[model samples]
Target: MSEEELNARHAEKMKKKKAARDKILATKTIEKGLLIVHTGKGKGKSTAAFGLVFRALGNGLKVGVVQFVKGKWETGERKILEHFPEQVTMTAMGDGFTWETQDRQRDIEAAKAAWERAKAMIMDEEHQMVLLDEMNIVLRYDYLDIADVIEFLKTKPADKHVIVTGRNAKDELIELADLVTEMEMVKHPFRAGVKAQKGIEF
Candidate 1:
């Protein structure tokens, strides 16, 4: 085909694509909060959740964050969010990972306390988005009752968005979530003897 003919064909194809996309978008009228879950044996689960928090902040929405693990370490996101106290309420409640603590009972207590704070944030009218960082890790260990957590989440305020991130998400939680993402790790630097670095890992 001539160059002019090729240009015309491409334009026609894009026009049809745009029309189809618009039609589908018009049918999606319902707007409400979402129960979003990020889980898998891969990196970037928590990173993705933090990205949503930043997006919410950009839109002038209030956010609440409860970190169930990595509380002892000072993370870059935590430091940045601290500057927006009026729009963000963050609590890092974990003592550290389970192996670091080495006490099952202590881990359970910490999980319980973090859940209490998380529940409060979910119910609080001021917050529009609440991020439950590493919640699945605690759930995987049975540190908190899954039944209770699911029930509470079911009854959360209709206009509030809840985000849970960590590996090994429970079957029940995945079933109840409105949106779920699983990260598949094809490669990672840790396997190549590169330790977790600032800004990249944390």
Candidate 2:
């Protein structure tokens, strides 16, 4: 086959695959939400959560993102997310980081505010997916009520998908999660005295 013919054949194959997936999904008729937790001592929790965001967006789903304790917008994801303000909404806690905040009480207040935003998103069924960035650490730091958060999440709209990402996800959160991934840090460049790099690690 010619190159163009091969390309057309590949496109047709993909179309068939998508059609099959749609058929199976329609037959199942499972109308419910998903609770996902990404946590551990390792890394990429937020990255994993954002990957879900991209997937949801690809499927034409609206997403709400609230970043707990990430006060700034210098990261690569932030830059891309900003371009899609209509499809993706984001709010960041005003504290630079946990250790840099200095004022513990004030940091807690910031985290609480971020949680409030996430709370609203969880309750809003209009949003197909809600991403609570680093919220696990916020709850672990005692900045928000774990019980309240879990209750809100559990009662979320049937089709809503909630993603919570951070280190040290509480036991209650883990129990509530239908899907959970714990990223254990086996080895990192930081251990070898390498600093965080742009585009790749971030």
Candidate 3:
């Protein structure tokens, strides 16, 4: 085809695409809090949730974060977010991973304590966004009662958004979530014997 013909054809196709996108956009008028789940074996689950925290803060929104399984080490995000103490509430509640703790009872206790903090954040009207980091792992191990968690989630205020991140999310939670993203692992450096580098893994 000639260059002029190609340009005209592309313009017509783009015009149609824009019209369809606009139509769809026009139909989306509903607005409410979302129950967002980020789970899977891949990396970046908590990273993605923290990105939303930054976006929310940028919009003058208050965010509450409770770390369930990553409390042993210091993270760069935590340090930066601490600077915005007025808008961000971050609590590192876990004692570390299950393997590191090596005690089922200790893990359970930690999970329970973390859940108490998370529940308070969920119910606090001051927080617009609450990130429950690594919550899925606790759920997978049955640390907290799923039914109780569901009840509180369903009763949260209409304008409070909740983000739960970790791997191996339960099916019940997935069913109740408004948006669920399962990150599929295509490749990872850990499998190649590469230890986690600073500012990337944390």
For each of the candidates, the C-alpha root-mean-square deviation to the true structure, in angstroms, is 1.3, 5.7, 1.4
Candidate No. with top lDDT: 1
Error of 3 at 23 (Å): 0.7
Q: Write the per-residue lDDT of candidate 1 for residues 96-139, one digit (tens) a residue.
A: 87888888888899899999999999998999999999999999
lDDT of 2: 0.84
**Model 2: per-residue lDDT, tens digit, 1-202?**
9999999999999999999999998898766788999999887888889989988877788999998867433488887777677788788887566788788888888887777888788787668899988888778878898888878777778788999888889999999898999999998888889976788676
- Judge candidate 3 against the unseen true structure and give its global Cα lDDT, from 0 to 1: 0.89
lDDT of 3 at 81: 92
TM-score of each: 0.95, 0.81, 0.95
Winning candidate number (TM-score):
1
Error of 1 at 162 (Å): 0.2
A best-first ranking of the candidates according to their TM-score comes to: 1, 3, 2
Candidate 1's TM-score: 0.95
Looking at model 2, the pairs that clash are none
lDDT of each: 0.91, 0.84, 0.89
